[model samples]
Target: MPPITPRKPQRRALLIGICYKHTHQDDWPELLLTHRDVDRFRALLRSRYDYADDEITVMKDDEAVPSRLWPTAQNIRRELDRLVRGTAAGDQLVLLFCGHSDQLDTEETKDKTEEDGQDEVIIACDAKRIVDNELKYRLVTSLHAGVNLTVRVLSLS
Candidate 1:
């Protein structure tokens, strides 16, 4: 029998961290570590895992570069689509969300409800909430065969 060769896995990642600085007034305190954590993670991925700079997208609330991506619902959705859609069979997808997340348990919605009766949400930089169910539908459900998907949530509040 001929020896089998292992295929190299294609790597893609989306990193989101929000401090919610300009969103609200003195009501909710800002997160101090989220942005730095994302930076560290990005650096690690680039240095250790051999992931290219273009292969990873970083979205933060206080991003100074206007040309760079920000953490918004539409932007996140678009990047998620790109990461998932462009993946092949031996690809690896990494999604890391670090910031304020919410749990909404409302009886008003008809279609989207979680098993615990509370819908999980990730609060974006633009103060938009992206539901977990919507994420599942958009990113998870459309995963190609043999693609390895890993999701990590680091919530500070």
Candidate 2:
């Protein structure tokens, strides 16, 4: 009898990490926690998937990334969509963000209600704050991505 051939599986990985400080501004904070997240996330992917170190992409909220590729909430959403749609089926995508997860009141607004027409939104690392509309945009983009999605948000716990 002829030998049966096996079909190999394909996998994909994506990364998002926040190396910035929310309480105070600095180029980037120097903390072991940040390093821990970097190591832990890499190890998690390495142990589970057969991805080479280079195959995985690391993104930060700091200057390490080009101003264009910074891991802003919107950019992260877009990259996730790309990773999910770009990879073949059976592949996986992982996203991690570590920093301040907060809400702020800014000068942006829309009619929330007849009484409370003005509203504010939460921003991540950007100097600007985001609003409900932006959040919705990001979410919709992610839903349309059509790939296995795994997201992790790390805060001071």
Candidate 3:
């Protein structure tokens, strides 16, 4: 048998949790434990998967600092762009989102994809709605070939 090569896949993770500090149309309840959930997942990534602290980008509403970005729709899109830019073949990217989700009617029905004619969205800290199609276009379609991307979304609503 020939010599075997070790599998050391390049792993990257983006963890986002929104507690909805502000709201617009709906009186959404604030999530007390969503931030904790992301923290726990971060721990798991480090202890179980050996992910470095610098390798993870955390965007939380209550825990937002100057260095760490906030969980806004614009920020999320920008981060997704950054992740796709840094990703290469055989690289692993994990995205985790914990917040409120809602189903809304989408325009441009000619290219409608959702089965129920309504688009699922993740509400951001600024009360902005990020449609599922937008996520797929920015994160999924932008990934390079052979890149492993996993998205975990935990919706409180």
TM-score of 3: 0.85
TM-score of 1: 0.86
Q: Write the per-residue lDDT of candidate 2 for residues 54-101, one digit (tens) a residue.
A: 657676656556765566767665665565554544445666656545
Model 1 misplacement above 4 A:
1-8, 25-28
Who wins the lDDT comparison? 3
* lDDT ranking of the models: 3, 1, 2
Per-candidate clashes, comma-separated:
0, 1, 0
Overall lDDT per candidate, in order of appearance: 0.81, 0.55, 0.82
Candidate 2 residue spans exceeding 4 A from truth: 1-10, 21-32, 61-78, 87-89, 104-125, 129-146
**Each prediction's TM-score against the native?**
0.86, 0.57, 0.85
Which lDDT tens digits does candidate 3 get at residues 1-157? Answer: 9998846667889999887765454656888888898999999999999999988988887644553488888888888888778576789899999999987876642337677788888888888888888889999888778999998999865
Residue 157's lDDT within candidate 3 is 59
lDDT of 3: 0.82
RMSD of 2: 6.5
